[model samples]
Target: MAVTRSLSTLIFDLGNVVITWDPRPALPEQYTGQDAEDLLTRLDFFTRNADHDAGKPFAEWVADLRSSGDAEGADALQHYVDHFDRSLVGLVRGTSQLIDDLKAAGVTLYALTNWSAETFHHAQAAAPALAQFDDILVSGEEGIAKPNPEIYTRALERWDLDVRTTGFLDDSEANIAGAESVGLTTHLFTNAVDARAWARDMTGAAGV
Candidate 1:
């Protein structure tokens, strides 16, 4: 059976859902193309990213990256990180189409992302498409991250939403489970083609 109209909101994960996520988009400028993956294996961007995402102090993380590795190479890497759009992984297939479709159908749209406050605005600027969201909940800004039920709670609770009728779409299973635990319907998003199609069909059926 299709979900009902009681779930009037559609929450989307930003990175893998709307725009793509490449942790080291600028690494090739600092290292050999083949070694980019190797360096990424050794470095933990996401781990270093946690503090920023939670909206805590993050000057230390930046300093560490600036000081690691060969001074020149590290500096080169820092330059890329400072200037290039590392988060511009690419638009997930069909993201624009889906968001546009959702708005046209009168479904409320939101972006629920575990992102750093430091880089979030920069990313939004780089990807002009982010402005489409009706509500944006960034982990850093909210001081909460997903996979944590609290974050999901904030999404519905703060918005006075009916969880059982709301939709949460993310690339992470943990996040999906978290949202589901809070009585929210979730889509375990993988590829954009199927996801966008699902979004269109599901929301249409729900009359949202």
Candidate 2:
């Protein structure tokens, strides 16, 4: 395919978009050389909750879950730290060639993700290319999350993007629908390869 249609901007989700985000690899390391098999079996640390990520602090999240009967075997006071220590390793992923490719095309790029301020800050080192974007919008700071219409609106608002000329890529169905609800094009990202193909397909831009 050749570059045919032009777009005002391209927005991307962070987790599985430009980064390799699989916590399974790092889970065992969490319990390695320990009595526990892995943290997954002992703790329900699968996904990030939007509410806690919005304005509530991480300490509040730890307290809420701790009160839910998920007792910490070690020092209860240190549970949050331990959890973050082992779990945060899941955030790192190398530079996405697809993003680089898009930037090379002189396309306006932006990061619209539901991430806490601290976590997103740490991500700065993990994914430096993220800074290359024209803009980055995180839900924690925005005080909203997808599929909430507000967050998407906030993104569009930041860029002064025309819904008709913008496209979004995310891993969640709800988020994609939310984007489409607001008049922007959406792609359900299955993997980096799939995302790259769909991006090209959507904008009628040829693959790199």
Clash totals in order? 1, 0
Q: Model 2: what TM-score?
A: 0.77
User: How many backbone clashes are present in model 2?
Assistant: 0
Residue by residue across 11-121, what tens digits does model 1's lDDT show? 999887888767666655656566766665555655666666777645555467566644544554455457557647678877777777677778888888998776677
Per-model CA lDDT versus the true structure: 0.74, 0.68
TM-score of each: 0.83, 0.77
Once superposed on the true structure, which residue ranges of model 2 sit more than 4 Å away at CA? 1-6, 22-48, 65-95, 204-207
After superposition on all CA atoms, how large is the RMSD of candidate 2?
A: 4.3
State how far residue 124 of model 1 sits from its true place (Å). Answer: 2.3
Candidate 1: global Cα-lDDT? 0.74
